[model samples]
Target: MIENNNLVERQYEAKNNDLAEEQHEIKKNNFVVDTEERENAIEPILGSELEGLDPSNYPLITPSIELTIKNRFSSWKIAKYYLKEYGRQKGFATKRYRVEFHRNRTVKKRTLTCEKAGKYKPNKTKPIGQQRNKGSKRTDCKCHVNLSSSEHTHYVHITFIYPEHNHTINADNKRFTTAFKHFDKSIMAEIEHAVVYGYCDIHMIRNLLQLKFSDQLFLMQDLSNAIQKIKCDKKVNRSDASHLLKFLLNQQKKEPTIFVQPLINVDSNRLCSIFWMTANQILLWSHYFDVVLHDNISRTNKYNFPLSLFILVDSEGKSRLGAQAFLNNETQESYKWVLQQTLDATSSEPNVFITDMDPAMNAACKNIYENTYYLYCIWHLLQNLPKRLKSKLALIEKYPNTYEYLHNTLYPTQQSWACVFVNRIFTVGMQSTQCIESINALIYKEVSSSLSMINVVEAIDSRMQKEALKCKFYNMEI
Candidate 1:
């Protein structure tokens, strides 16, 4: 009887253990089902295209990439990009949480989490009046994705994912998230193209991009930031002055007859002035250098460097661009250097040099081309008459002070500007600096004060090319 009772007790103990095991297994399966159901509940509604797809046979990752584990990427950049896209799709922002780098500066591992992943701890030591009134966006979210790479592999792989977020994911709120504000490569290319060729301001650029990409969200500040970065990238390890010099040197290489002279300061070893003349410009100067018009355009570049243009009249009675210079200052020395460069390049001097009433330029012309007739632009002189007298001129009788002032100014400068006095010198029927002023206006249309030195050079070159084409066409017609 004792042996039978012992056997019964052992059987009962084994039966209880089996029942416990069965219950535990059921609970574990339920937990897994609950977790999966929760994940499915948070997923966005699929479009009609996915209506016939089977959930179990569906690809683990979508074409746009999903927050799924074991999804390998070629580099950490790609992995992070996918994470940002995933967050955008799910109506949340993502950020880098932690990164592990190897001694060689290569990435070993990285963790990306919801932007609201950590708690925003208020600075306890802050003064009461200095506390910010804006509420914090952080909610202590635990959702994150992990990436890893092994020593033998250079490929960045998504090793793990915790795809649950404590915050509600609203598609309408996606635009407010930083992740959705990110620009893709195509958008970046468009921005760069606009910056380079479109020549539009930031607001106009934003409007154009918004119109082109109707579905994309844009902020004025963000577009400005992007434009700044694009401009910086264009420099390519060179400053504006150095890049301009390099561009001119390259141009000279293409055409051996082209002349490029850069004046560097001995004390600072910095570029102070530069002059360039293309082969075609030299050819034009060789023919039309008898009556040269010179003037300066200020504020043509970011550095406010003064751009001087030389103009000459061709046989067809049309003005042609002869040469160009960028001077650091409007001093006599700078002007003299430019005139010397022009004379050296063409090996000829202008019979009549015309310019505005600039004393420095006049002195330089007198020093360099002593035999040349120095003529002043009558239009510029008349424009300055009122300013010199400190009053605007109406009819001479109405403003007698202006008449007297004009008489005084004109009597002294008659030989320099009076058409009758200058008739002795051949001027190609040109009297004023109107041709150079027109060229300056054309340059202003292409370049702005915000442009870099290199951009100013390129814009001026482009304008010169257009003029050259026009001249060639006219010559062909003639």
Candidate 2:
């Protein structure tokens, strides 16, 4: 009997050996005929020959075959092929179920499932290589947690300048006090608050200064009217205003690491600020001086250096150093004693005192330490010399003989005469105390908020960090 089972019409020849030995193949998913007259090959339609016929689908499978007595392949081969094809068709459903299981599973359950799923002995053809590094989102790694730019940012230099001439500042205690007491107090308190918080927003302070002291940012209409307006402004509450002012005024009232000095040098043409690697520059250990007189005292005429000392990092980016007040009466002996005690108390004594050739400072350092070295502050000496000689300091460059002699003498060691004149000069024009003036200006502008001695010390510490960053960048450029 001849049979035609494929989508392509083909006749299978089972016998007829006298004419020619003939064979036909149906198991290669293709039809092959070697019949009495010819050998021909035909590829069958993909998935077209199915045992269970479906109008919409076909079977795609192949096997090496020899027809059995019943004219069929083994049932075991058919079953195995069906199982593989069925698993492939339901992949989406199986994947959905697996994801649900993983989500609901406990640690123990997940471990068991992961182990079981991975247990298959993969085909030798399966690839093997290192697994790719997992991304943080999928694997829940800690690398992304709390990432902030602040960690990398060096210290910032923040400065607040107070309005120098505000009329509302002074109060006539003996007068009627007719103006709204709350308004006056509020204005004053706001000014004090800006100094502490490093910001301001009072209207009257702005107008009175003729410059913006927190400017229109405040609720008040003008510096004079700020007294009346603060009462109506909801932001300025009476209870909180008093407390806030008090808190800011008492800035940096923390317990300081104590330093006791046996031989202290208080009288410097500039400041005597120490640079500590670990601790902050303790400006309280040194007195500060500034451009203006304090209004806190009743005497309106007395001239006093605000002593707004600042401790800030220099432009070099090292730790902050305490800045000194501007020129004033040489520092007091009691102050000297205290400073010496403080320096001695630190990790190591700051032995070299840098300052201009002011008699008081020179005498103070000489008396304080026998072995400690004192270098004449180059800047201070340069500044004072020109004033004494009544001509510009640059003239030294123009006049080579005295200028070269003076410049060469200013050496680090005492072995040469150049070291002697530069070290111990005879004229006022050659003596310069330049560094302290710059340091003093910084203290007033960037560090000191008010004339309060306590606040001055705090400002010094705060300002040093910023100044150091500046110094570091400047040096890097150089």
Candidate 3:
């Protein structure tokens, strides 16, 4: 019985020895794999250092790389090329590491680092009832290539590098794995130029980019972000009232004759600015056309402010823009303020002032320019005639002259619209407020209600300049 027990113990000891040998072999294999990985990491850095050097002069250990031909302008480009070539050879994904931006948003410094992939187990234990944290497992691969500008040298330096990747390199798709890729400077410049010239539509800009850089690949979102960044850098905001006012003030300062009057609200101190060319325009109006056409366009701007345009005829018989005013409301107070500003700017009351039959506008014109004849716009009166006569249509069956009765009741006299009753000398062959209406149509073509007040003003100015050029061309042809 003792011998049987000893035999069993001996057998168990032999099995334990066999298991120990297997474990030793497994650990030996693991050590080989780790050593190989470390060697792979260090090889690329050595290769980069010895790239352009004589093979005989290649040292046992290369601490840093030295560029034989120093380039100040293309330093970043050279660094990126080296990083890209290393990524291709090493077979790992790379990304931007640390980036520094200049005040004007140019890249002052940039670093490319390996994207370490795989799950990492933390050393700390989890508390009871707490879930395990699924934190990003990016390994400390210590792989990086840094490019920095040196002001003293006036050159970009490839300051540091660890050209080693812990993760498996994607050699098959090296282009897709490159880090810190961006549009070329030339492409970015073209995009900025397009935006400044009002070709700001994203889709159109995308098409332009594709056309210009056919070989290069770019994502739509990247292009969009670039555009937004450019606009933000330019400080272009349609909603900024203060900036708009400042822009107008600058214009006024540059041109002494450009009259700009800001009406301040007593309570809020909010402003409504009226603009006009006072110096030459007033003299032109006094000498040539004594007629003034006023029209109010509502809900045509982002602010919902009623834009009032004062127009006059030039010597060439073209409809000329005389003045522009913005109002928060179509009240008598607003109209009075606008009219009073006009009177102050021009210093001459118009002989004939034409407007739509708004009671506030009519009263303001009457009170401000007592000697001026206020003629109602026939087109506007006729537009309302249909709505007013809808109920009176039933009364037309009872009375044969019902239409004439309503017309006379609404119009009161013929001098308002009828050319026969108007003074021929003052009419200048103009019977209606068509000139002002045309100006409103021209403005609406260039601007929308969604546009900021500043953009609207810019569009108006652009349209005026275009029209003036057209007029000049026509006169030259004649």
Candidate 4:
């Protein structure tokens, strides 16, 4: 009973794991209907082509297999023709049998009886009177008599029948496709524009925009046909056809890793993800992400920073993904939409956030999540410091003792060796955003830049998904 209970618990756990939520910071993530969902939603596919022979109208025919063969031909060669009993294979070595012959001629029937191979004593050294060797031997007619090869043809017969009436129900693609295809045409057109602009190009864009079924993701075969139709495109070569469709995809990207900068505030600024991404995790992060969407986004979200990004790790630890943002210098564009999308793509709680000591981002964090901690990257701070002090960094580097004194021994201390860089030379706290620029360059490695707006989104979406799967498994949902 305990064993059974454990098995049931394990099964339940597996079921729950399979139900992993599709909580998207929209990763632009999509959903796929499961079997149970489809079945419960009113349509179940039961294929019955021949009328009147449907399973509901007619009893389901189940074929039976029998392994017992009696009074049969003795020719071992013909034994192969009589029947077969299948028991399983490999581990079980199981074999199953099917009846192969039915002869009309009268045949002898026999029973199998066992005979003892060894003798046994009744008592100590002597056999009991009259019961000397009881059950030692028994007579049975179970026998095999080989027929001459010449008579073989006269004794053996075999029959074969058409396999009929085996069936199972599956999801009805036809019905589902019909419903899917008939979705709002306007949405379809938009998706096509997005999908095509993502996967293909602008030339075919106009024509695809006019398509009625633009809102639906076509069946695999139908999608193939649609691409084939593009053979006539004058501006797009057959080779480049795939590129036209690969809108959001960076052709060169192995994958991408996105850097993040969560909102931080005195109330909530430590931004859980940032503080969690400690200095020890440098190896955990490297170059594996990208940047796209050529638009000037303004840094405006009160609770989140512009291009608040995340990271992904593939099954093979060797390959990583990094994400970066597009900026026309300091002003970020469409920030609210971007932040929302990033949130959809990443976890509500983030893992790492590498950003400048920007107050706007700090305020955003305090607004969205009131309990997270944000760690300022030491690297980003180094880069930003040069803007404040002219020759202070040079002096700090020249006066190594002062630099060490200020940065290491006396951070907040006004008088220290590192004072040239920290206190004497520049202004800004100990926390930094040093590697933020380098990290951004690394992420761009995988994000598509040459592609159109639509294609870039698609590629980013695809890459992000593969990466996000890894994150989900690791519980790095943010």
For residue 148, model 4's alpha carbon misses the true position, in angstroms, by 60
How well is each residue in 1-478 modelled by candidate 3, as lDDT tens digits?
9999999999999999999999998898788777546644544332344455443332223133333222222345445555554564565655676889777666788877776633366665667457666676487777776677733222355666665566544444433433423665677787787666754444457678788777555554456556656765776564346745665676677667767777766788676654555455556666654888888887566788888888888777878777777787888878888888787887788888888888888778878988888788888878876665556556766454565655655557466667677755476677678878778887887567765666566555555555655675566546
RMSD (Å) of each candidate, 1 decimal: 18.0, 29.6, 20.1, 29.8
Quote the positional error of residue 192 for candidate 2 in Å: 9.9
Off by over 4 Å in 2: 1-278, 282-319, 323-335, 386-438, 446-451, 454-458, 465-478
Q: TM-score of model 2 relative to the true fold? A: 0.30
lDDT of 1 by residue, 1-478 (tens): 9999999999999999999999999998798777546644654322223345442222222455454564666556556655766777676878989999888888899999988899987766778887765878899999998888765455666778898888877665664555566666667888898777775445457788888778677765456557667877874334677767776886677679999999999999899999999998999998888899998989888788899889988887877888999899999999999999998899999988899989899889889998888889988887876565653345544567666766775677688887788887788877889877777887787678887877677666667666765665555546
Measured with C-alpha atoms, the lDDT of residue 303 in candidate 4 is 23
Give the top-scoring candidate (lDDT): 1
Candidates sorted by lDDT, best first: 1, 3, 4, 2
Evaluation by lDDT, superior candidate among 1 and 2: 1
Q: Quote the lDDT for 117 in model 1.
A: 92
lDDT minimum window of 10 residues, candidate 3? 62-71
Q: Itemize residue pairs with steric clashes in candidate 3.
A: 91-169, 91-170, 92-169
Deviation in angstroms for 301 in model 1?
0.8
Off by over 4 Å in 1: 1-237, 388-412, 472-478
What lDDT would candidate 3 get against the real structure? 0.66
